[model samples]
Target: MKRLIHFAACLACFTVFLLGPTIASAGVSKKAQSDFEKNLLGKDVKALLDMPAYKDGLDLYVDHKVDKRLDERGIDLKDLSKYLKDKGVGVERDEWVTITDAKIDSDRIEIHLGGGGEGHGASKNAAKKGAGYKRAGGSRINFRYGRDLTDADVQADTFLPLLGRVLDTSKIIGVVIPKDVAPQFQEAIRSRDVVVGMSYQMVLISFGEPDQKKVDDSTDDSLHETWYYLKDGHRWVVKFVNGKVGKVQVF
Candidate 1:
């Protein structure tokens, strides 16, 4: 009986010796785990990446591939890009987009934004209602560790500073300020205001792609480029001389 007890103790020690390294390296760091649980999971985070979602959503992915594309899941996403090609704009860059859901596996964290992509039901519902279908876009960022993840990898990712690199840089079209813009360019963009002296680029930055554009070639030196915005019975005509706002007409 004493021998049996001694043998059991020896076997236990042997097991520990074999599994000690694995047990130590089984998971991530204490701080990473703590941050993920306390600051991440079920919490909203501003990834601060150049992910410009469509009015619907933008598809983004990280190095960690959590799953196949939603299109493979029977979503008719083939025409999504083609159909939304001409759509004016989606989410404004530099805004807090979303972190609707996240899936954390032993090796990676799969994060989803804007409901993780469009659903078939949503498209059908819009079609049923006799309205054009507008499914909000989403991104799936998979924080991957090619090898076993350590604390450092998770702490310094591209998207979440607390996590690892965000390997998604698709369709990032922000307001273009070709040159030095007005002092109130940001304010004007916020207020949707366009005044004289705002450069053509500033106006483009303030507003998105205009509805119409007409150029005046009558002058020899400086050509006047007229941009018009028409929406919901509101009309704005902005004339730019030498790329600077010369006149603004509202109707």
Candidate 2:
């Protein structure tokens, strides 16, 4: 009986010794970490700042600490450390970032950030600084349409496909629009409209972000998601089934 007890005790200790590191590192799965890196490495910081998804809750980190110096820019130096500790959202201020490493705990993804030094946000050598994406000729484009132009004049087939080509070729993260239905997407954007088959991303680009959102799982069928937009004197409600716009209700 004494030998049996000693054997059991030794086996328990051996189990813990063998499984300790595996358990410690099992907080986040390997696929989750890889997905984070694949999507975020070497992306523009300003565009990320404007993203609704990232702004909602994604946490970011920086290797260099925030500067607290008071300069001619009239920046405040007080309570900066406390503020960063309380709110972990300031890494987007960098013009661009190259994700150095991504570590995920059970709750959040800790992105180890590296970027251009101070006053180097627009540095042409972004790739040399970190493992960033190859710089596209132009990342952002703004168009000013004349009042006389109408949907008929725009040539949806030609213009829409061209835009999709540009976005696909640039390989920008998160701006996915299918090339096959480029004409349909073009009409949606030009008219600021939504249809049954349009994607959530397409709706956002078409009419901008929604003013409010809600989720409903009351039915025994499936999850239903809705986004409400108030414009001029009208309210637009868009419903989604499995992440694609299923219907639109106007009030």
Candidate 3:
């Protein structure tokens, strides 16, 4: 009996030794975990990196009621609500957008206004409802990951965030910017200043994508590039070195 107990202890230690690095790598820093849980997971509709498994078939939770236009347009619910509210139209309370699949690949999250209803009676319902009610289209958002992202792809990503910001600005179901940080984003957008150390995500929130991207591969780093946004017949030039903002020029 004593020999068996000693062997069990040795096996446990061996298991720990073998799994130590994996355990460490799998473990998230407290701050990062908290950010994922609080800022993402439930708050935002998209994620850039691999987040915790959020239940692929689970419905997305919206803190507020959605409008009927969401069903037709397949856009963000909060935007629909704001437009109705501004128009003095009553907000509809019967609709919700389910997360068709929360587990996008490591680089992107695609969220449709309504789940595909794979296991549910969606197909049957669609047949019954006639051909007018089409399935909602999904929006795929990719993370920049500190690279010099192109204008087109970056602009595509800004759609959801822009809607989220609209909700945040109107104070109706704040999702993109946490209430505490909404002011900062609003201020950044107003000032038109891409701060010295802002990340690719921050730049998207601030000014969105430029109209064009000019690459400079003459240097060793092919990643070096400049992005240009046009305004008032002038160009706003943003230079990126190593994927972070290096210079800002308004010409």
Candidate 4:
């Protein structure tokens, strides 16, 4: 009987996993979607890289909300590029981007993405120092690495296919930034006097504006809004009760 019960439990778990999507699709909750969208709006990508829960939430949002939204709009690769450009994000054409350096932080990983350009223009000088491949673009793309980076650590790696998808679909050149920049950026965020009811402009003055903001009215009384720091994928939740900052949570 015990063995039978264990088998039954495993079957139930598998059944739930199989039915999860059908149940979700049958009655997709607009409130949940709205809440998620609210949180992602103007959030910095860096903040998300720092928190496991928020990162998982982002994955869920991408799978359920972003994918569906794109589908509903009939958006294709070209369309996504246009959308990103319209939002004032830079997009490059036919350029090669690579990860230059990678390092681990307490809650995140710092990566630097750069190409040969500007001051470091197209020279094997950086690569000679073991900074990875040299590109022709004369510019480098820097990325702050989070803890979730995959084992392969290659640009074409399969662990995070969505990242590759975004890079391929968009016109912008994608590269990882220098690993050293992480400490400096972290110091900057820590020093900033983040406050509640602060306008986006004000936040930018301190920590720069987030890449996106996920807004929701139904958030707990403690949290007024959630912001994502794009550069590092770290996040901040501004909490309030009576229109004042009651607390702050960083993920």
Number of the predicted model whose lDDT against the real structure is largest: 1
TM-score of each: 0.35, 0.29, 0.27, 0.20
Query: What is the number of residue pairs that collide in model 2?
Result: 0
User: Model 2 residue 248 lDDT?
Assistant: 91
> Model 2, which residues run further than 4 Å from truth?
1-182
Q: How many clashes would you count in candidate 4?
A: 57
Model 3 weakest 10-residue run by lDDT = 48-57
Worst 10 residues of 1 by lDDT: 164-173
Query: What tens digits encode model 4's per-residue C-alpha lDDT throughout 1-251?
Result: 99999999999999999998666444323453344334222222221111111001111122323455543112233443332222222213333334333332332323333321323232334334332332232222222233233323323232134343222311122233344434444333333545544444435545556666655476455435556563222366654444444455666
Model 1 scores a TM of 0.35
RMSD of each: 12.8, 17.9, 16.4, 19.6
Query: Tens digits of per-residue lDDT for model 3 on 87-126?
Result: 2211111222333332332223343223322322333443
lDDT of 2 at 55: 17
Query: Highest TM-score, which number?
Result: 1
Residue-wise C-alpha lDDT for candidate 2, range 2-66, written one tens digit per residue: 99999999999999999986765454345544654565456433322211111122222211123
Better model by lDDT, 1 or 4?
1
Candidate 1 lDDT over residue span 1-251, tens digit each: 99999999999999999999797677776667666544444443333333322323333333323445433212223433442333312222233445566555666665666555544444444344332333356444454544556565455243353232232111221234444554566556544468888876667766668999998886487788899997323588889888888998878
Off by over 4 Å in 4: 1-190, 196-200, 218-223, 230-233, 239-246
| Collision count for each candidate, in order | 8, 0, 0, 57
Instruction: By lDDT, rank the candidates, best first.
Output: 1, 2, 3, 4
Indicate whether candidate 1 or candidate 3 has the larger lDDT.
1
Mark the 10 consecutive residues where model 2 has the least summed lDDT: 47-56
Which scores greater on TM-score, model 1 or model 2? Answer: 1
